[model samples]
Target chain A: MKTEEMITRLAEGLRPVRRMPSPPVMLALWTLLAASVIGLAALVFGTREGLDRPMTRFDMMHSLAALLTALLAGLAAFELALPDRDRRWAWLPLPAIGLWLGTMGVGCVGELVRLGAEGIRFHVSWPCLQFIIGLGLPMAGLMLWLTRHAAWIRPGPVAGFGALSAAAFASIGLTLVHPTFGPLMVLAWHGVAVLAVTGLAALFGPRLAWRVPA
Target chain B: MSHAQPLCLMLAPGQVARDARDLRWSTLMAAAQEGDGAAYATLLAECLPFLRAICRARLRDAAEAEDAVQDALLTLHRVRHTYDPARPFRPWVAAIAERRALDRLRRRGRQVARETLLDDAAELGAEGEAEERLAACQLREAVGELPQAQRTALQLTKIEQLSLQEASARSGMSIGALKVATHRALHSLRRRLTGGAP
Candidate 1:
């Protein structure tokens, strides 16, 4: 069919679609759902060593950092999903992400000082990795579904941010249950899981999300 | 005598004119998204020429470019809901059109490759008299494996080179029946020869 004819047909058959909620609103909804899912998972699976210690300042600070990262990254992903939006909007989440990494760095340094050079060991916690990733899966699924309507001009970055958002939130849940290992171990394993999710999402997002009929 | 045209004409003036016109497209799109059918039609109509121009610039073949334009229109229709009113319209539409054209280009590339392979196979098939005889013998064996009625019909019509009426009379079957049997026999033999089935 000719382009003009097809356009006419499309316009004639047009139906009003409900306008999508703004990115922030959608991000808020996703954050609420992600928190609930992660909470439920933590309740069911049990934390690494059990929550015997009362909420400490470090714990609260790290959790807040994680929450901020997730929220900011989710907002970035939402903006990136749209076509023709200013690409600069992607940098909005960077400060939060940097702060989160900085906080992790501080914690690592503190641990190193406490343990002394000879005592420091890079421990790999298999259970911790499994828990963060497990919690991330549902969150990632929800985020993908929420953003499926996006124009997806930048699928790789959008998918990466979406996965990072999910993994960041999942890390918060992991911190609640998992025993504190050295900062390096947390960084290594959690970083690996987050990268894995980001890589997979980038690879598969164009195929699975934002499917335009052939 | 007519005045001689300049050899180098600047495109900036025409581009500026087009850009001015395209500025209203976002307004039309926003209105259309609110269920204004006439506005939607106008928006789509306005997009048609621009889309065609983009496709033509990217594609060498006119027919392929037209096909790409249609595909882009279809995709734009499907994804219209994704358009944000606050954003400019041209980039969104252009992105969709460019992606669709790229997809068409890739599919055409693959199709050209497959056609090349088929041409090579045809060349191989035309090798020599010995190979031709061998192929004919294999085809005959494949046809002989068909049901008795189909085999008889194929033999009388194809191998004996008889007319449809003659084959029907010789096989003691109606013409339509003979035609159906011959078609089935040929289909079965082709499948077998092509290694698709026994």
Candidate 2:
């Protein structure tokens, strides 16, 4: 082909793809997500072991678990709806950070309410590890997931930025539980998770092409 | 290879005679990369006639001639990143342009097959005779520059030998809507030829 004509065709011939999902679909997804969180919260709050005994500390710990579960479920479902973006951003840090923050906030609040007169005590024991798993994991996972090894958004970079963004958001939740865990642990965990999530996001986020025309 | 050659194997008499600007391989590439519209215009203007001749000699339709060139250009821009800075540009561009033109021809044939299936109509597969093909090229030489879409629709369906359905699919035109594209190509071809012949 003539180079000029060929060039002209390229400039002139291209057409935009237009098959993006509608707003109603987005609203529906959001609504379903909200309902799931509420339902799980109710389920956690409603179950009182022997009807009046008010349940043990271990059993009453369902509130944090339920919140984490709801966040996970909602993110997983929404990830599936994003086309071409596919499975890339679906995994790791995004929902994990949010869930972790939520878990910490709810768990600390519930613990305080339960042990009113005595208040809650901190120990670096196995349950302390449980505290980490329920609260710490989300923040840590989110941070690591967001930041890449090099921490840049250059093309072909594999780190997902959204995960980092999630971690940053989740920090608020983590700080809420700081009274039970000290400033040192909160700062440490929050620091690691935020850096990780942000780095990953910088590396991988731009590849999403969220608004590709068909 | 250290040297670059125009590999079309079929250049016509006046095809190279007209639209002769920035004919040297390096100059055109530099112009194109630098976003000089005039240089681009010259580069395309020089190449269109020969490319059209190839389309005409093969396809037997004025419309397809323009499309072959248009598609080739679009392919050129899309894959521009692949061009080697150290090499002569013509050969690289020619290879892409030729492949794109052939692809358009094939896609056009596919579309015709599909449209025929839908209507239970016999598809127009241009059969026999050298004169018809040459005439088609002559017609294309005159009026190949209209809208890119129209050029593409015509080239794929006619010269490249795609059926309407297949052409429609690649072009993102519905089977029902392709007739408009066909009309536009032919009408422009007629107007250009009446005023002056290429």
Candidate 3:
């Protein structure tokens, strides 16, 4: 049809659409939902044994970093979801990720320094994998649903940060209940789960996210 | 790639006036979000030239550019709820226009890759007069099956080579109606001939 006629038809069909929440508001809502879901997971799984034990300095640092990572990654995902947003904003979570990884790396070194090779004991942690996935799936679903419109323009980045946010938040919950066993164990199983989740989400995100209008 | 700049920058004559216009668009869009059809219509009508300029810039083919503009308009309508009144309207519309134009270019690229144009000499020398006649017969039948208004619009505009204004006057339809009818007729014919490719 002629452009003018198309415009007229569009105008004829005009109806008030509820505006999407601002990015910060969406992030807040997502955080609330994510917290509820993760709390439910923690409750179902039960907090780790020795829940009464005080956290070490390293443990507190690691947890704090994980929290920051989740929040920053979530913010980045929301920002990237805006069509006019600069893609460079995808790096907003980089520092948080670096800090989280850095703390984990330090913990690993400390464990090795204290216990030598024995501290690096590695075994498949099925429970850890299950917990991460269980906590992550719902959060990822929420992220994808929230940012589905933006996915049409920047699917990979949006999905990557979204998955990272979910995975990082899941890690925080996993840490609360799952025994560190050793820093290496946490890195081996928990880290792998996070990577696996992010990789899988980014890979399939376009299909799982909303398709562009035909 | 060079044409990938923001449409407002490329089309707007002066920054100050453009900013004022942008503010007006945002206000109209806000009103549109509240279901004011007049505001929505004015906003869209004002945006047409800018959208056209951007699409035409991205797509060298005039027909393709027009199609892209329509696609962008449809997309804008669908995603109207996503707009924030706090943000400038130009970028939102520009981004959609650019994306639609790029989509058209990509589709054209894929088509070009898959198709090889036949030489005029080869087509003329082919021994396929019977097949051509059959195709023409099928096309005529498809045209005949169109709604009366569309058939007349198509015949006046495409077959009889009349301008849209001439066709509108002849058919006793408004220019907009004539254009819509002709577009529908062509789209219908394409679908029938291409088995729903259109």
Candidate 4:
């Protein structure tokens, strides 16, 4: 079509669009939704037994890091969705990710010190995969819905952040309920889940997120 | 700091005019988001010169530059909601135009490469043609793997250089089906060759 005709057609078809919320607002919205969904799922499934056991410092640190990573990654996704935003904003989640990894590393070393080679024993936990990914489905879906319109330019990275956020949030809820495993098991299974979710979302999100001109 | 403040105050005439234009465009865009057709039309019309300049600067071919401008306009229309009223508009539009121009450039470059390589292959005839031959072999292998319908459509339309009507009659598929099959075949070939990188 001629440019003039396209412009006229576009103008004729114009309709009021709901402005996307700012990144911080979107982050808050995702956080609330994620918390509610994950928390409800945990409540429904019931938390890990040992409710009276004292929480360790590592447990607290790990939870905080996951939460921070989710929030930062969510924010990055929203920020990167806009066409005018700097691409460097993609680095927003890096520090939190580093912290999360560091906490796992520290926990692994602490386990090794306390229990020798037995601490790092690898165990295949089917429930870990099921809970993380299964619970993560809704969170990822919600994120994709929220960013559907905004992610025209950077859909892959945005969806990646969305998946990361969802997976991390799912991990947090899973930790509260699922029986604690060895640090190595947590690292292996949980890391795999996160990678799988991120990779899949990144692979398919562009196709799902936007309708580009032919 | 005081000295620099005075220097900063002395804005150039061109900068002042550009800033004013940006503010006007932003206001129009904000209005356009509210479904103001006149505002949207005027905004797009006003943006033509700048978009043309950007496209022309980046794309040497007139037709391609024009196409890029149209693409930019379409993109701007599609993502109008992404424009925050608080931000300046020029950067947003410029970014879209620049991205579209670069896309056109990349596409043009790829087309040139393919055409040149094909021409080189034909010219080489009996001489060393290892690289082009390998590429052709890979493409042929990929095409061989396509589904029967898509392969027939591609062969009839692309390899045989038949018109869609002729290809449709020969393949016993409607024109629309042929078009879709041919498109999918090309897409599949591209994905196979590029390893699914978009």
Q: Distance from true position, residue B162, model 1, in Å?
A: 44
Evaluate all candidate structures by whole-model CA lDDT and list the values in order: 0.74, 0.46, 0.81, 0.82
lDDT of 2 by residue, B1-198 (tens): 111123333367544732232246447655556565565566667666655554555456666756655655554543343344355455555554455556566777998988666444323444433455566686767446767777777877876566675466456666666778877787878877677452
> lDDT tens string, model 3, B99-182?
889988998997786554433434675667557768989998998899999998988889767557545534558889988999
Among these predicted structures, which one has the highest TM-score? 4
Please compute DockQ, using alpha carbons, for every candidate against the native two-chain complex: 0.21, 0.04, 0.37, 0.30
Better of 2 and 3 by lDDT: 3
> In candidate 2, what are the lDDT values of residues A51-139, reduced to their tens digit?
45454343233334333433443343333322112345446434554555554565556656777636645334332233333433343
RMSD of every prediction: 12.1, 18.6, 8.2, 9.4
Model 2 C-alpha lDDT versus the unseen true structure: 0.46
Give the winner by DockQ: 3
> If both were scored by TM-score, which would come out higher, candidate 1 or candidate 4?
4
Sort order, lDDT high to low? 4, 3, 1, 2
Which pairs in model 1 have colliding backbones? Answer: none
Q: Which stretches of candidate 2 lie over 4 Å from their true place?
A: A1-214, B1-23, B115-198
**Cα miss at B6, model 4 (Å)?**
23
Per-model chain A TM: 0.89, 0.30, 0.93, 0.93
CAPRI-style class, candidate 2: incorrect
Model 3: per-residue Cα lDDT over A1-214, one tens digit each = 4678767767775778889888889889988988898788778878888768898887788888888988889989888877666668888899999998888888889889998885466789998898887778667877888888765466788888898999989988998788877677777777888898888888888677745321
Q: What would the TM-score be for candidate 3 when compared with the true structure?
A: 0.77
